[model samples]
Target chain A: MGISAVKYLLVFVVSVLLQVLFCNNILIARVIAPFIYILFIVLLPFDTPRSLLLFLSLALGLTIDVFTNTPGVHASACLIIGFLRPVILNLITSRETLESVAAPRVKTMGFHWFVTYTIFMVVIHHFFLFFIEAFTFEGFLLTLLRIVLSSVLSIALILLSQYLIFRK
Target chain B: MKNLFKLIYRYHVVFLFVLLETLSLSMVVTFNNYQRAAFFDSGNFLSGTLFEKFSSFAQIFEFKQVNIKMAEENAVLRSALQEMLLKSNHGTYHSSDSIYLPRIARDSSQKAVYRFTTARVINNSVNQQHNFITINKGRHDGIKPDMGVISNGQVVGLVTNVSENFSTVISLLNSKWKISAKIKRNDYFGSLSWDGKDYRRVQLNEMPYHVPVQNGDTVVTTGYSSSFPEGIIIGTISDFSIGSGSNFYKIEVMLAADFKNLVIVGLIENKQLNEIKHLESLNKYGN
Candidate 1:
């Protein structure tokens, strides 16, 4: 494997461990908890192969699912985000930067672009995760609240870690 | 064949995406069916060990909350014991229907009625519409599906799935849960269900409007099914109103057990459940 591939694997391990061990237990206000494991998917090299990306997303989600005891909820959500990542990148980044940019970081991509990208991905991930978990529209408002609150927390944490850990 | 190969290669990413999503969703849909028979859940070896380690470390900070809940449970148990003693002393216990004593005497020909097993709640959730609780006891501990769970003499939920060493309970707060309940004063029975709105309040429907239902009236299970015994405390009527153009009363009840603070519970196994079901099924064909 290449050096960059090894680095991405390390990031995946750290993100999953942080999420299952600490974030899962921290129930803020007895409702919302941040899920930062999506950071591994968001920070993958810009030109990562689509099949590789999809497989990594599945593995990441299943690992978290094994810990949380919700078998497929996370896996399905992660898969959706992985399939749409390329489309979201094309929409957010110009062709000139798309060809040049190696990875998605606050330094590589401008602050505004990174923030928008993280927010969009986090919202979509949380929306699918919460809806699939509930499996019904009975409590629509409550589920919406959970999705919104959790997305905000997740985006904030992802951005903080990107700036602190990925300083370049 | 060359053109077909090129087409397949071009759309392979989309095909893989669809394949993985379908597999994951099927896993979610069939989760309940295979969960009990298989050990792929959090209760299994690898995942269970990881959770156990995390919990042991996290439990230190939760000690204060655990202590408070224990104290509250102790208070509820003490009050219940005092009430039972008072009833026995006043000579009113035998007159009323008592769950502890069976209507039939202990004769050698009669089999056991109900058996109780204690379990600890390792994980619980009340925030979701369909809530489930995971208990540390399971099939190895004489627990099975369709068993009724109670805490401090109040209704908690029903056991729906069980593995070798763990069981999942459908909490009373879940929208799918329903129980046969009646007013303590008049024996007027109604179907109790949750509205998925609040954790503390559940709704009792189909009560005849003429029945003099009042706030604070006690509600208890009717024991109509083998899942739970008769006279188990469910809740108390908190509010009631007659729906317009309807002949039934819409009553709201405050649940007896605080699901959010649940830790220890009792699993009730009806020893006569199979026999009762067998006899009832015999009557289905008008025999």
Candidate 2:
């Protein structure tokens, strides 16, 4: 319990700081921004209670929200991303995958599978975020452009960050 | 019963996420009338302090340029002061919405709706009809929507959206934006618009053809706008002509500010913008 608590807390603080200081600042094409902090929610323990992860995700999202001054944009995006993480993870990891020793890193799940999991969640989170930011169909084209550009930039950054932090 | 419990437990994370996202987006969609959540804006206490740190760095790089700009501005102010000093005219020139600022950055506050703020153009898009300029200001810097943005002395566009520490500005060159302005020499005015073909040239329309026009006349704000002061220096008349079939003039004004080389900027905030908007709305409702 102590070990698990320590790890979760560590990821939480580090993820929030990283998102505010670096990932959010790195604008590719001036439209694309990386919400790399979603990975903290993504990497929560498998047996962590559904209620707990859900609660934690809300807390994590809101903290970033306060820092970002976006009202509830990040909180909602993080919550949705955090919630769907397990469903996607379950789908990505197949039968007999339980015995896997390495965690969610590339060593445990090969590069292809890892990319698939990260890309799928990132796209969903980004899609919802860009749509909410627009908040109107009058901005349909602008919103769509933002989603496409931001998604690509986010995917690249997520992959690179993961490689550096969780080296194979 | 056990299977039911298991299913709920298994998908619980998904359920919670959807709920939270719904809550956040609802806040945005409902900002029409009741702005209860406005207090939680990016300009709120903690976030403002964090962004203020970066604003310091941005201010540092701007020191040399800012000094030069102040000197030129001082010269302009002194001349304006000279006119006022001789004639004893102090209150007439200031437009009702124009509030004198000790510093331009202080105008970026909660009361600012049409406020303009500066950011370094790290990247920008001009070819697209919906061009956006990515700037270093974001949620932390009190940047918000519908805020009129400018670079140098010319109108750029508005703050369309914001992130935590940075934001994206919709450039005036974008097809979606049409800014309010008037001729400096005459009251004849029109909407300043972009054609999406060239970033350098934008078109001004709606000027009556009957109005006496010259090639090198000054065009200033009408003082009819809540966003800009009476003489914020938008541009100079470059060319004009009467369309073959229309009653209005088609004119192009050469912008005084070099749009491409814009770095530091001062955002304008109309002090009385909200009250005026409210009054306009009330009249529409009454009608």
Candidate 3:
């Protein structure tokens, strides 16, 4: 474990703190929820094994749920995305293109493609996450509206963070 | 078995990711439905103490703003106090046993002494049909359900529920609010309820169209019940109109309290509330 190991740990701790404090505090109408914390999973080292990716995603979701008090909504969504990421990445990018890349970045995937990919994954995750969190159809329409609204918000935040911090 | 273990060990990253993702999703679902983890909230004495340490530092920055606002408010209140004293000197008043104004520096002849204990409003919601105020005081602080709550000497609402360290109040302007009140000057009394249109106004019902009511008349609680201690200020008559083909006059009241900037409050314990409630319910249930 060298400087790289320490840097990764620092990044993980800081991301969690920021997610809890800043992102969650901006609950627009108490509906739109930002899961930009998923950016951690989304940026995992390329060639990271599928099962490890799933496990880390699960850990990330559970940590958030523990803090915020919304239980399994995030954990389950992260699993499905983790399992499908390989397929989705393959569908969007060729084997040769991903081979040269270490992680998902605007530079590797190209800006428009990266944004589109993020919007899709974040929206899918939020839809299942919110639907399960609501846990009822009494206000089914309201739940859908919340999902759509939060997805847009979370995607915007993720895109902005990526644009600001990571050129690639 | 040895080969399988080796293969899983070799691909541990994939396994780790899957396990972590599954764990995270479960937390979200359980939290939403069961709220199991909420029991472990920072309310634990240990974490609470830690947060309290942080709050002391935070309060340093907040105190200046609060004190400055209070000082400016004190100046405005002084003028209002003078006006009230002048009005009372005109000798137009009613004597009630419930409202005990102990501090009458101007007139040493003050009657019943109403004591006030201030509490902070930590959370409030005006969007609900039955709006509620979460005050930071609770059973530890002598707050109980059915007690009267007031701000600036006027009725705000009644205490409805109490947690160990928190209590919820049903504000008067809520649509679900219905409190018995009467005209302070006369025997005419009615129920006050809000129609949810304005935060400043409420509707008075059941007053017969012939009560000789007029605009700017003072309205106070009849105190016919134990929820309030008789004659707590409710509001003043703002406007009145006769409903189409109805036997009652639809009346609007401008509440006597400025509800939005509530900082200090008083929770009144009638001391006899439970006994009164027991008697009233006995009549209905015959138990």
Candidate topping TM-score: 1
Candidate 2 per-residue lDDT over residues A34-144, each given as its tens digit = 677887776665666666777787788777765544556666777777777767877878746734543576666678987898788888988887665444566677667
Kindly report the root-mean-square deviation of model 3 from the true structure over all alpha carbons: 9.4
Q: Is the docking of candidate 2 incorrect, acceptable, medium or high quality?
A: acceptable
Cα-based lDDT at residue B244, candidate 3: 89
lDDT of 2 at A66: 58
For the candidates in turn, chain A alone yields TM-scores of 0.96, 0.89, 0.88
Candidate 2 per-residue lDDT, tens place, B112-134, comes to: 23333456554443433345555
List per-prediction Cα lDDT, in the order shown. 0.80, 0.64, 0.66
Estimate the TM-score of every prediction: 0.81, 0.62, 0.51
What is the overall TM-score of model 1 with all chains considered together? Answer: 0.81
| RMSD (CA, Å), each prediction | 4.6, 8.4, 9.4
Candidate 2 Cα misplacement greater than 4 A, ranges? A2-7, A67-69, A95-103, A137-145, A163-168, B1-15, B32-36, B57-221, B225-227, B233-287
Candidate 1, superposed: residue stretches over 4 Å from native: A2-35, A66-69, A95-100, A137-142, A161-168, B31-40, B64-75, B78-112, B240-250, B281-287
Off by over 4 Å in 3: A29-33, A163-168, B1-39, B42-65, B68-287
